[model samples]
Every structure is written in C-alpha cells, then in structure tokens.
Target: MSLPPRRPRLPLRARWSAGLATAFALALATAAPAAGGKARAAEPPYEARLAPYYGQHLDWHPCGKPAPRPAAGRAAAARERGFSCAEVRVPLDYADPGGAEVRLSVARKPANGPGERLGSLLLNPGGPGGSAVDFLTGYAGEHYPEAVRARYDLVGVDPRGVGHSAPVHCLDGPAMDRWAATDLTPDDAAETAALRRSFHGFADACRSRTGELLGHVSTAEAARDLDLVRAVLGERRLDYVGASYGTYLGAAYAELFPRRVGRMVLDGAMDPSISSRRLNLDQTAGFETAFRAFLRDCARHEDCPLPAAHPAANRALAAFLHALDRAPLRTGDSTRKLTEAQATTGILAALYTEAAWPALRRALAAARSGDKDGTMLLSMSDAYYERGADGHYSPLMAANAAVNCLDAPAAFTGPAAVRAALPDFEKASPVFGRALAWTALTCADWPHRATGTPHRVTAPGAPPIVVVGTTRDPATPYRWARSLAAQLTSGHLLTYDGDGHTAYNRGSTCVDTALTTYLLTGTPPTPHTTCH
Candidate 1:
C-alpha cells in the first residue's frame, strides 16, 4: 500500500543504463502483518468447494474506454493494444462461498507466437491499490522483454478494491483535499488533535463508502482471489511478476498453495518477518540513502541547484524543509500552499527512480524561489500517492490504508508512542522522519484490528522463485530482498547493482535477460546470484 509519498511503505520505475558504473555498482537490498489473524479459517482443499468459481467462464470482449486522466483512465487498455478484456467474480468473504461476490477486472494480450505458448503470466504493480490492469495496458506488455511476451499471455487483474474492481471510495474531493492539507507533523496538542480528526475523518469516509468491504480487503483474501484468477485463466500453476507490495501478495500465494507454484519473479521483495514498526523504520533509512544519492547526482549536474559542498548541500535541503514548516509558501494557485507534508512527499516521489531526479532538481530550484515549483512538486507527489486533479482521490489510497491496516495492527500505539520514537526516526533522516513518523500513526486508530503476525514464507514444494533487489531502493530496502531470499525454500537472488526501486528492466540488460530467461524457460538463477 502507499506509504506517505516517498515515506510511503509501498511504491517503481524500470530502466537500462548500458551498465553505467553508478548503476552497476549498487546491486542490493530490501515489513509485517498482525496475529490470531487467520485471514480465513482453514477451509476445504482446493477444487472441492470452489469448482463453480473455477468452472465459471469469462466471456472475453472489448472493454469500454474510460474517462481521461484526472477523470479516471480506461480500465481495459488491452483491446487498444490488440488484446482482450473480461471480468471474474470471486466471493467477497470466502467464508460465505455463495454470498456477495466481488468482481475483478482483467485484461490480457495473447503471445505473439513462434515459440510454444507458455501459460498466462500475471503482472501486479505494488500499491495494494495500483491497478494491475492499468499497469499491464500502459507498461507491462510493451515494456516487458519480447521473448517473455512471446511465450506467455501477459495478464493483468486489478485486485479486489482497486481500480475497475468494486473500488472503495470514501471522502469526496474537497474533504480529501482538507485531509491532505492537514499538517502531518503537528506541533502541539491542538494540531495533533486536528491530525487525529483527519485520520478518523478519512477512515469514516472509507467505511461509509465501502460498507463491509473495509473489512474484507485483506492481503490473504486478495491472494485467494489471485488463485481463482489463475484457475479462470486456465493455468495449473501461477506464472507471475509481482513487485513491491505485490511481492507480499506473491509470497502469500506461495504460502497458501505451495504445490501450485510455477515460474514467479518477486522484485523489490518484502520481508514478512518484520513488524509494522520495523517496516517504517527501515523504509525511513532507505529514503535517506536515496536522498543522499540524489545529492551526489545534484552536485554533478551542470544545472545543479544545490551547493557544491557535501554537508552544506544536505544542510540547505534540511533548512528548506524547516522553512516550509514555519511558513508554507503560496502555490501557483492562490488557494493552495506548499506545506511540509507535500514537500516531503514531493521529495519521496522523486526518490522512487533515477528518471525522476531531474524533475526533483527543477522542483527544488523552483521551491527556492516561488510557488510554481510548489504546485509542480505537490502535483508530482500527489500523483505518486494517486491523488488526482480537483483534489478528488481514488479508491487506491483508501484501499491502500484499508488493506495495510487490516493485514497488520497499527505501527504506532498513540501520539505518546510517536513522540517517544521521534528522535530515532529523525536521526534516520532529518527531512522525512517526522512526517513519516506521524504518518506511521495513520492506522493507529484503525477501526479494525488485524489477525496475522509476521513470519517467514518458505513456499515449501514450490519451484525456484526469482527474487530481485536494487541496493538503494528508496521504498523497499535491499536488505529485504536478501532476507526474503533467505526465508524462501527456493529463492534465487538476482541483484541489479543499481539505483532504483526494482532491478528488472530498469536499464539493466543483465537483469532483463536473466528475468526473460526464467520466464520463458522456467530456468532460475543460481542461489545467491548477483547481477549488475
């Protein structure tokens, strides 16, 4: 799920730099759920009670075009890309197999033949809320390596509660705008209380809009839904590419059905062994590492906006944040201003990939002078958070919070806990620690308490799972990939020594070639392999 912009717990970009030293040098790294939290009470084995769902057929057809950007884009772009679209219904609460059904929107591009066709390859971009259909149509098919695409039918399904599905809508535009504007790093009791109000306000809106769905959007439920999608797609074993938070979803799938696993790639993997607190703290350090890399790049740029000196430039960035806190500058729009929260988010958004660095530099230079950058930066960050124009939001954000909160208990106990943890978080990164620390309090007062605790996922009896990690990924840390690789029964680590959230297709021919080979041939890298 989306953390808070860069501070967000979940977030990606793909690149290939002909193996630049800066890119090749960093191949690297790497959160929780809650307990008594059996997502679903143990049920009958597969193919018994779920046969109706498995037997159901989706009548593939051309999906209708959606409204334009800021207005919600098309849910099925596969048709535009010479593919097909369909919908599959799964139980809302699996416990009641015959009860309310949740519709999952799906899209697929058939393989451009020559090679014997592999089964379907399902793709999921992170965001617990990110639209897998959107990802498939917009990026996956065209961008995924050709050999892999030729062998497997590329499939995308927006998980339950995400776009095109029965999305969970809460607050409207204006209320959401007000919620976003509330100071994340409140200074006193009154502001803190106001911040508390914003949290409750958002939660209440989501509950009201979602009804019982707010309780049903758990990760385990989504994983079960994924299996049904696999069955619907006619795949005996799931062939999947899941990134960031999707890695967690992939892990759950392997755990739930170890024998049904096929060739799976989990890039920017998550360590299911950590608690929510460790998840936030580790991500804090990650952003700091990414920001430092940005500074290094900034110093090298001809149009460099920061000071030439090392500590001096870092200090300047920190001071700019402090200035924004004291007096948020006016934006291009008179009604809106650049607050500390937005600025921090803007920075975090840029940290996602090296491609975003130029925009960050321009935004920073603008911030030093007027509100134009303020509007631009805020827009950039908000877009990353899935906040659209007109201050309206998507179920992506609402569902992000809902899924994460229900998957695990709150990271923060209360304001007192946050206050006590402030110094440690701040020391991790002076720029983002405070807002992220406060943002970690988001699910604290969550209406529901979660059931599952953090644990290792061995995926016993499964085929080799390829796990990729980028050393300085600002969102999901590299250490996570390493840890996850160790936990899995048969995880092969593919290290893209680069600066980005993920390794595959992020300009690394090495990473892409390795992934394509695995996808097409079911061949995985050697255990503990490193690629730059």
Candidate 2:
C-alpha cells in the first residue's frame, strides 16, 4: 500500500484520465485547511459568533446572538426526534479573523441514548462542493448506525459557496446548455481554436458571474469554517467522516488540527502527494477498468448492445460521435439538443456506478438506432454543472471547480501544453484522452492561483484514522485509498474487494458494519482488514 514518493507538477493536458475528472463537484468540492504548529486558544467549549455575521453581510441584521442550538425538519426521526439547525459565523479570511465574515449552515441529529453522549460527528460527502447540510438532512442522518446515533450527534454543514450558502452560480439554463454542448475534443486547428474560445468564455463567465466567491472558495477557507462549526457544536474535539474528495478535506483537517481529531474516517481517499496529472491519469485507468467491467457484463447479457466485434463497436461508436459532432439529434424538444458532447458526458456518467450500466446499455442501443431518449437521460446524470429545468444548479459544479482550482497548482496554461501531453494521455486512455486533456484547460485560464501546495498528510499525534478503498473504484481509485492509508502515520487500510466510487454505502454489509463499529465505539479496524 506504500505510495511512490511524489514528484513535481506536470505540464497540463500531457496526460488524460477518467477517474481523475472528479470536480469535488459532488464527491468533494471542498477541502480542509492546513494545520500549523501553534495551538489555538481554547474558548468556552461552545459560544456562538454573531457580531461578525452582522458586521459583514450588511443586507440583513440578526435578531440577537443566541447560543448554538440544533434544528430538525419533520422527516428527522430520533429516539427523541427533532435535532436543530444553527448558523455559525466564521471569518471570510482565516488570516484575518477580524475581517469579513461568512455564515455556515449547520444541521444536527442530536444524540439519543440512556448512556452519556460523546460529541458531534460532522459528515461530508466529498464533492469539494457537496452540501453537507443536505447530505445530513437527506442521507447520512437516516443511515448512520443506531449505536453511533445514540452516542454522538450527527452533523452536516453546507461549506462556503455550496448549497444555501453564498453560492457561486455562473450560467443560466440556456447558457449552460450551450456550455455543456461545446465540443470537448477538437479534431483540427480551427476546431481547437473554437474549443479554446469556449473554455475562455466559460472561465470568463465564472469570473464575471461569481466574482468574489470564486477566489474565496478555496479548501483552506472551508477547513477553517469546519473548525468554527466544531467549536459552535460544543465539541472539544472534531469527529468526522469524509468520502471521495472528503478524504482530502479530512486529511487537511487532520493536518491542521491533529490534536482535535477523534475517530475520523476518510473513505475512497485521494493522494495529496502526487501531481495532479498523475492523479488524473491514475483515475483514467481506474475508469477504464470499471468500464471494461461494464463491457464484460454487457457482453454476457442477452441484450448486449455493443457489437461483438471490438473493431466494429469502436468504429461505430466513433462514427456516431462524428455524426453527432457535426449535426446533433433534434430530440424533438425545444430545450435539449442531443450533441456528441452530451453523449460523451453520458458515457462518463455511466462509468460512475455499476447501477448505471443498464442505462448506459440502453442509451448506447438507442444511439446506435439513431434515437436520443436513452442517451439524454444519461446526459442529465452527467449534467451536474448545468442548471436543472427548475433554473438552478446544485451549486456543486461551481464550488467543485473553485475548490480544486484553488487547492492544487494549475496543470496546464493552454492548448500547447495539452498537445504536448497527447502521447501520455492517449496511452492512459485512448478513447477519452482528448476530452480529458481539455479538462486541464479550465484551470490554465482560471483567474486564481492555488493558495496551497500538494503536501503529505501525516498527523503524527492524531488518533487512528480508518481509510477504506474499493479494489476497482473509478473516481477516487483504490490505489489512492491505499496510498492515503500508507501516507498517514496512524492510518489503517480497509479493503473492499469490489467496485464503484465508494465502498461503505454501496452495498457491502461488511464495510458498513466495520465503519459503524468504528464510529460508534472508537475502534479502528486492524490494519489491512478486508471486507468482501
């Protein structure tokens, strides 16, 4: 499980990847802040910060400073029922706590037990940009182990620039439709120029649209906010579970607050030591592995759609892409146009979950028959960046880009770098190289420079952190999980001998049981534990 020593950053687009394309957009759009040697002053375990909230957002005045309390919606079920939601105001800039402020939306499912309660367990579903509050209210609270629930209050917070916070939406519906439809893999100089124009336009739109929020949505800032939430929750220490990009956040937190960590779990981890290009390339290989698994399953099915002849299947798929690239299907609808980019987007989406295989098969079958309905549905799955029909995005994509672009150094500066990387990227993913190569282009033209550098996260004094990895995970690959586990001094690697983005919630009872036991009882699975 030992990872190779990290290298310097690679020139962007020189490599391509599949599992590598994660936006932190729903998987981990935020990152935890860096830790320093200085110990933070201990305040009353929890008091609310309200004056800063009033001084900053001149738009509204607070009623009064209330002590941090929990809020619950109707659907929340408890041994007692009904937790609380609160706003914890933190400085917009950690370097200057007296400066501007931002509001963090925090939700809690309080402890319900005859036994003494522990503290809050903050949960994040890695999308650098995923809504912790939404994940809390909708998913983690209901599914968490009953024992864990009885002892610790489950908490979720919407990170800055994420859902219901000061969001960073750049495009409206029509504009988004066009953006998603833009050709990703250009064939020639002219087309490449057009692609570059689109990339610049997209960056410009984000800058012009999001303005201040874009630069402010760095992972370091979000990490500080998490500490604020931890303080307001009356917890002397922080306990958390972070998945996908959440691993990075957890690592960042552990790095920043080693002494405060209590039973942290970073599942489907990301390796912070590797260069972004290497990271993306490994992800590409992971996706290809997953897609081949899908292809194997598809080939065995009675209704297999891809041609038996690999050459024909590959050729036919290419032809279809070319046709759609030139003249997209009408779909006979006013809003949606089934373009080649949309189809590519769908294929990428299907690679995320094995449950998506049936949809991918059906979509490919329809596209082979020149119909677009099936493929369109897949496109919607891939359309996280777009505003939904209701005229709003999940704030996932915008925050995802902002966090990632700010966390790591840029991979490329322009198309020249991409062209140079073609050979390496093509070797990594022949089918997806060009498109993914363009992915690095977004950051090259980004308005912000990374505020942080890629560094190893080894909290020397932190409690044992359980790290889980699925053998063939596509997005945050299994190797990353292994690498992260090896990197941390007290990390224990838990292996899920299966597939998909994450292991615990994706049907492995063994993984679920192990994680629940750890969270509930403060026990770490023995090193190299395997769950089938």
Q: TM-scores across all candidates? A: 0.91, 0.84
RMSD of each: 4.6, 7.8
lDDT of 2: 0.64
Per-candidate Cα lDDT values, in order, are 0.74, 0.64
Model 2 is weakest, by summed lDDT over 10 consecutive residues, at: 1-10
Model 1 C-alpha lDDT versus the unseen true structure:
0.74
Q: Report the C-alpha lDDT of model 1 over 327-443, residue by residue, as the tens digit.
A: 887777787888877787667767777877887788888888644358767766566556655666656667677777777767887889989999988898876787877888778
Clash tally for model 2: 23
Clashes of 1: 28
Task: Give the best candidate by lDDT.
Answer: 1
Each prediction's number of clashing residue pairs = 28, 23
